[model samples]
Target: MLRWRPWLPPLLPLLSLLTLLVLSDLTSSSPTAAPTETGAGWSPPAPVNHLTCYFCENVENNYICNRFAIDHPCPAGTTFCRTLHIMDTRGGSVVVNKHCATEDQCRDDRVGCLQQDHQKTCVSCCHSSYCNEPVPTNYSNAVRQPKPTAPTRAVKSAGAAAAPRLLLLLAAAASRLLLLLAAAASRQLLSGSRQL
Candidate 1:
């Protein structure tokens, strides 16, 4: 009587593939299903937590400004944009800073403004994503504009979306590697059996 044990080696790979597929399906569905069901009538809103601004800081007569300004995501509890202009007559230096701010920091339209001799400082705050894109070239003539207050609470961060994507990629690579190993092992077993 021929034993059935010889067939088990070839079946192991098929079984492993099915198991991985089932596990992937289960993991992918758990996190996304509830959100889709609850938001049936409402489409998800765009991510507005990220802020972009033009940032340049000059001190001691050093000047720096570029077109390739980067977008910086605010930390938790920071929802406003701020632009600061400072000028000092000591050496005729001007500094500009654009970055994320908090509700308290931006409470007043102007955070700081002082003029002494040729020294001056001007700060303006606004509550909108990318609102600080424009940098005031003329610190003495820049005007502060009123802006709406943003919500004080911090929203969900964008990094939450990256984890699942990474997991999926790793799963795909593992599945492919398992398949190749199984193929090689099966081929070796067939050759050995034929030689018996």
Candidate 2:
């Protein structure tokens, strides 16, 4: 009665049709409609990790932090034309980022490159060389020997270049002395001859 009361006000025509159909056979009736389900969704893929040089763990974001926008979709003609986005972080915000067409350009730790008109790029974060850090195996006077210490910042000596200037001045002074002695000897000899 509650359901009929709300609908009865506006559903007069449908109600009249059911009343007319009451005279029809009760056994034979139209089937009810079925409902449909849309199962349309996708699961997100896991993020991958990139290994790089020890010194270059951090990557800078683009001019804008963390956000990178690209207009070109690749492979209009070939499979090799696929382009991938690279996420890089800088500061608290992500600033540095680049895109690359090949795995060689984007993922290769040894080699970094940029493609597609500088719109995309890859960079190196190469691991530290074996000798950069000390290893225990080389201890206790081992035959293999320990790695040498990395050179530190030192002021270069300018002593070498300054030495030559002193030598040049000494040579000039020696030549001047020889000339003065020759002049004195010549003058003395001439004066003695004239007096005689």
Candidate 3:
């Protein structure tokens, strides 16, 4: 018991080495470490929650449909793809619009008969991604019909959230490594003092 100080000097280095080894194992074995190595230069995209719809609006005789192949990301809370076809006064003016629609807007197909013109709007809702690629033909007998089952296009996966977590893990590992090294150095100094 009187010479406990000398024994402590040797044990300190052993304890520090063991801690370093354990920390190395933890850092390497962490799940986030693998992705961090591979995705070093890459950042994940944001999470996609909105539907991309083909949007076009044209007046009759313009036949300007598809003029712009714009992929519109619908506003949040709007989950369905919609196609609206309108006929004005015996096709005098026809307008078609494709866009993201809400559930209420896609409740049913509506036809309005005005004094000088008849307007027919076909509302269709689709749950799948980019399901409104094709324009709707029948607007008069509208119902909330699901698009036919077909091969769905692959959506881009977003990885924006993962990068930050990986960075935090790396920081933690580096800090732990630094602490271990400091402990080892202190142990060395104590042992040297005992020799003096």
Give all candidates' CA lDDT scores: 0.61, 0.33, 0.57
Q: Candidates 1 and 2: which is better by TM-score?
A: 1
lDDT of 2 by residue, 34-53 (tens): 34344354433433332111
How well does candidate 3 match the true structure in TM-score terms? 0.40
Candidate 3 displacement at residue 32 in angstroms: 11
**Candidate 2: where is the Cα deviation over 4 Å?**
1-157
Q: Best by lDDT, which number?
A: 1
Lowest lDDT 10-mer window, candidate 2?
Answer: 130-139
Summing lDDT over every window of 10 consecutive residues in candidate 3, give the lowest-scoring window. Answer: 108-117
Cα deviation at 91, candidate 3, in Å, is: 6.1
TM-score of each: 0.41, 0.24, 0.40
lDDT of 1: 0.61
Model 1 clashes, total count: 0
Cα shift from native, residue 112, model 2 (Å) = 27
| Candidate 1 vs 3: which has more lDDT | 1
Question: Clash pairs of candidate 3?
Answer: 44-159, 60-94
Model 3 lDDT per residue over 32-128, tens place: 3223456665444444665777676663422455556576577777877776666555544366777777877766433222232365444456766
Clashes of 3: 2
Tell me how many clashing residue pairs each candidate has. 0, 12, 2
